[model samples]
Target: MAEIYRVAVHYGNDNGFVEYNLETKTIKVDLAHDEKRREAEEYLAKEHTIAVAQDGIRDFKDQKVNAAQDVESFKLALTRMWEAIDLHVDWSRPA
Candidate 1:
């Protein structure tokens, strides 16, 4: 038997819920309350993408600015940027 975890998430003017099955490693989204579910989904997806991109950009900028005169620090900063990119890609994948 698999364990299922349920979570309710609210954003903007829309309300939605998500269910995760641990054993199968799958997630299901339920947007039952919203009349415009498709539009709301699209809007939320776009907002999430934009937010992730902004965070990555901000992190990269901060890392570069703080790395000033240290070669090792700059290399570490680059590594952080690459890691952020990988994370963003993973996060944006469709369920």
Candidate 2:
């Protein structure tokens, strides 16, 4: 089975929530009690930005791995990618 990761962020008195599925790459914004949906929209925008940034870093890391000329170089690239993934995941957590 494929592993799935999920995260959510909440905002405002209306209890607006935004859920992001990193494995499936989907965002679900729930603002049922919000009349204007401003909080939901903001959440969506922030999620989009985060996803784009993550993708960019992943692509760059992949390129570096692909260009690695030796086993040590490949391992170094993988280590760097792992560190990047850790930082990104940490930053995405709801506070």
Off by over 4 Å in 1: 33-95
Can you give the TM-score per candidate against the true fold? 0.32, 0.30
lDDT of 1 by residue, 14-87 (tens): 45554445665444447655544444333322312111223554552322222222333322322333233221
Among residues 3 or more apart in sequence or in different chains, the pairs in candidate 2 whose N, CA or C atoms overlap within 3 Å are none
lDDT of 2 by residue, 1-95 (tens): 43323333333333333434444444444555553345333423331211112355455322332212333332233233223322111225552
RMSD to native, candidate 2: 12.5
Q: Roughly what TM-score does model 2 have, to 2 decimal places?
A: 0.30
Taking every candidate in turn, the Cα RMSD to the unseen true structure, in Å, is 14.2, 12.5
Instruction: Count residue pairs with overlapping backbones in model 1.
Output: 0
